[model samples]
Structure formats: structure tokens, C-alpha cells
Target: MSEVPEAEVVFVVADLAGYTALTEAHGSKQAASVVTRYVELAQEALEPGTRLVERAGDELLIVADDAARALRVAARLRDAVEREPLFPTVRVGIHAGRALEQDGRYFGTPLNVAARVAAHARGGQILCTEEVRRLAGEPDDVEYRPVGPVRFKNVTDPIVIVEVVAGRRAGEPTAVDPVCRMLVRPETAPARLPFAGRTYHFCSFECARAFAERPEAYAEA
Candidate 1:
């Protein structure tokens, strides 16, 4: 057995919401594809100081020395998942405190609390403890709304939880593909087509071809 190393760090756990239902609806193979994509997207979204502790099915445990960066990474993960048409929304929970690391895994009150907080979050929501907010400070791009003290199983006392609000800023232009419903930027879209007297953008050529094949199938009613 290895000794547990203690350190003050920020922990984040992100899990796919309604994963079981998605799997039931789409079968295991499709669900696995979504999970694989989510893991890849998360790895790309994390900041330099963050390390992926481990992955448990549809959930990922990540740690970082910078609390603010952890929060930003959570936001980015959520946004990335939202932009994927095949994946469900992700719920993220963050906490900053002293934790114990053993065998490349984290254990301690902070880690447990973060996992519990993640369970409380709804689809596409990011919840964090008050300590995380204090350490991270206020973010200009996102608003923090207090959800009040929440009680978790196996934890004494109520923990103050806050929701991180991140949305498209004003005047930010966005386009959604009708075939897959994924957000696409007009300038960088893989494929663009004119249909029904309007221009449509797609993330992939396959989606553009599908739309072109049956415009009536994807065209808005």
C-alpha cells in the first residue's frame, strides 16, 4: 500500500445526466460512443494545471491547483458536450479543500463532498461549494447564483452551493445544423448548403448530405 499524500487542491467531477436512459434508448454501442466522445472532449477542455485523476464510466474526476481554472474547465466541458448532438448534457460539481491522494486516486472529505454535490446538480448545471467560489473569486464571463446550503449523505453540516451561469454573450452569432442540431459557426462549418431560401451550416459533410437528400425531413415546420 502507498502512503496518502495530502494537498490543497480543487476537485471537479463531471457526469453525464440521464446516462442510463440514453443507453436504454440508444443501446450500449451508441452510449459507449457518446461516453468516449465526452472523455476526449473533456481532455481537450482541461487547463494545463489540471490532471485527470480517473474515469468511472460516464463520470470523470479531475484535480487542479488553480480553483478558477478548474471552474473554467468545467464550463468548457459543459459547453463542449452541449454542442455535441449525440451526447447528453453533463453535470459538474467543484470543491476546493485539502484532499488525500493515493495510488493516483483522490480520497478525503473534499472529494466525497464534490461527488455528492455533483449528484445534486441537474443536467447541464455546474454546482460548487462556497470555498471554491472564495478561492476562485468572481468570473466576468459567468454569473454565480447561490442555491443555499445543501445536505449530503455522510456529510455533517449543510454545505453552501452555488450555480455557475454561463450562456452565450450578446451579439454572439451561432448556427445550428438541422440534421444533427449541433452548434456550428458559419465561417468554419465543414459544409454549407442553401435550402428553402435559407443557408444552413453543418458540422460534417455527412450531415450536410443528409439534409440535402431530404430537405423536407429536416426543414423546420
Candidate 2:
């Protein structure tokens, strides 16, 4: 067996939220297509900044130049997939401290931290370490909510976390779904029906119809 090489590499861990539900609901073929599409979309958004080297199950391992670019790409990945039906929401976990490279694979505390971040994301969010935030350029209206210190599954230090706000396009105003707490586009979700003036976005027609069926019920809730 070859020895692990210590080269201080930065690793990225990310995944799709509700992926299992999607797969079970759509079946294997459809699930594969959507998962593949999601991977492609994320790759497209993170290209030129990070290179995807390994894809396993619903998780991805990407190596980047440094912590800064990794965090940037994480935000981009979440933004790229949040609106698409392929993946409801993408969550990212990034820890950019150090890693050992062996046989073209990266391993270390950073990688573990990133994996934990990805694991902890609620929905359509990015969880990253303070080290990553240190390298992250600047706050551009993206809320970096502090998640406090967390003791990860592996490694020593209790990593600090900050939630990365999803990126928005130019000339676009962010819309939040009052019902389910998801961000949606005005043009994309115009079909959504609601009360006098306010509009709500549901993950699917089922959610919309459910809301429509009991307007007062959801409105009050």
C-alpha cells in the first residue's frame, strides 16, 4: 500500500437534500437522470474554479486551489441547483485546512469537516468552517449566520460554522415562500396561486393544490 502524501490540499464535500425521497419517488432511471443532471449543473457552475475528481452515491469530492475558491464554488453550486426540479436543494460542506493526497484522493480533517457540514445542512444551504470564511472574499448581501462551534464526527477541534447565503443573479429580486420557507423566482412560480396579493411557492403541484385546498389552514399556520 502506498503511503498517504501530506501536501496540504483543500477538499470539498457536497450533496443534494431530499435526494433519497426524490429517487424513491421517481424510481431508478428517472432518479439517475436527475442526479446526473444535478451533478452536471453543479460542475458547470463550479468549473474553472474547482475540478470534480470523485463522485460516490449522492456525494461529491472536489479539490480546489484554496479555501477561498472552494467557498465561492460552494455558494455557486447551491445557487445553480436550487431552482431546478432535478434537485430541490443542494447543500455544501467545506473545510479548507489541510489534507493528505494519496493515489489521486484527498484525505484529512478538512475533508471530514466538509463532509460534516454537508451532512448538517437543513436545506438549500452551505456550511463552512471559519478558515473557509477567512478566505472567502467579502459578504455580498449573503447572510453568514453563525452556527456556533460544533464537534465534528472526526478530528479534534470544534469547527466554527457560517451559513452561506445563496447567490442571486443580476436584476433579480429574491422571493421567499411563506409557507415552506423556500426561495423562488417570480417568473418561475407565477403558476402558484394565493390570496389577494401574496403568492406562495410549493415544491410541486401537490403542495400548491394542498395549500389551495385549505387556504385559511395554511395561511394561519
Candidate 3:
């Protein structure tokens, strides 16, 4: 092991949302391709002050010298993944605090918070802790909305989470999954069904099945 030095940095954790479902539905080869493309796109989106710290299967940990810069990078990553046809949606969680860095890896409470926050987010959403929201201040065209406080396992204090909204780019057609509320691109949706003269797009077959079982329940909702 190497020496651990404390550093103040912005941590961002991102992963493909619905990754497990994608693997089970599409098999290992397609899942592996998704991971590979994710890494490529993420690396290309990196700015000067930010660096990719680690990649574990479908998840990525990135560190940035500044909170605002990290938020920009995160948003860019989200957009990149969204525009890619047939790729699963990406979810991101960000936080800023002191963490021990050793041999190009990071460890500490802040990192854990970021990971937990990421897990809380649905696909296509960007979430950040209050610390990050405060540090990043108010960037132009970006808004942070509070999602409420959440307690994480092994974390002593409850973290106030916020959704980082940059707004969706115009002209991209997307629909909401009635069951999970995940945003699905109509062109890439794996499952779609027609009901009541309107078509519903789903991110997965399971959601489609649920909708089929009770069309009125979701159609009205």
C-alpha cells in the first residue's frame, strides 16, 4: 500500500442505469460492449481539471479539482450517453469533501456518500449532495433541486440530496416508462405496446408486461 494523503476534491460516481437488466436481457457480450462504450465516452468528456479515477465494471469514479467543473463534466457525460442509440441511460452522483488519496485511488466518507447517492438516482438523472450543491454555487443554466434527505448504510449523518438539472436538449424524442418512470428514447426502447390508441415505450420488457397486465392503471397515471 502507498501513503494516503488527504485532499479536497469533487467526487463523481456514474454508472449505466438498468445495467443488470440490460445484461440479463441482452446477454454478456452486449453488456460488455456497453461498458466499453461508456468508458470511451466518459474519457472523451473529461476536462482539464477532472480525471477518471477508477472504473469498476459498469461504474466509474471521477475526481475533479473544482465542484463546478465536476458538475459540467458529469452533465456532459449524461448527454453523451443519452444520445448514443441503444445504449443504456446513465446516472450520476456527485459530492465534494476531503478524502484520502493513495496510488491514484480515493477512499473516505465522501466517496461512500457519492456512491450511495448514485445508487439512489434513477437512470438519466444527475444527483448530488448538499455539500456539492453549496460548493458549486449557481452555475448558469444549471439548477439544483432538493430531493430530500437520505440515510445511507455505514454513513453516520443523513445526506441531503439534490437533483442536478441541466434541462434536456431540444429535438430529442423521448417517452416515460409508465411503470418505472424512466425516460426512454422511442427509437431505442426495447419494449413498446399500444393501448387506448396511444403507444407506450418501456425501458424493459418487465415494465411493458406490468403495463399490459393493467393498462388502465398506468394509462391514467
* Residue pair clashes in candidate 1: none
Q: Judge candidate 3 against the unseen true structure and give its global Cα lDDT, from 0 to 1.
A: 0.86
Compare the candidates by lDDT and give the number of the best one: 3
Q: Model 2: per-residue lDDT, tens digit, 72-129?
A: 7777777677656424566788777657776677767667778888898876778877
lDDT of 3 by residue, 17-104 (tens): 7677677656789789889999999998899999998999999999999999999999989988877766677899998899998768
Name the top TM-score candidate: 3
- Of candidates 3 and 1, the better by lDDT: 3
Who is ahead in lDDT, 1 or 2?
A: 1
User: Each model's C-alpha lDDT?
Assistant: 0.83, 0.69, 0.86
TM-score, cand. 3 vs. native? 0.83
lDDT string, candidate 1, 1-221, tens digits:
66666899899999987677566544689778988898999998888999887999999999999988898899888887777754466899999889877768787899999999999998778999999999889877878999999998889999999998865533232676666554466888889998778889876787788888988977776
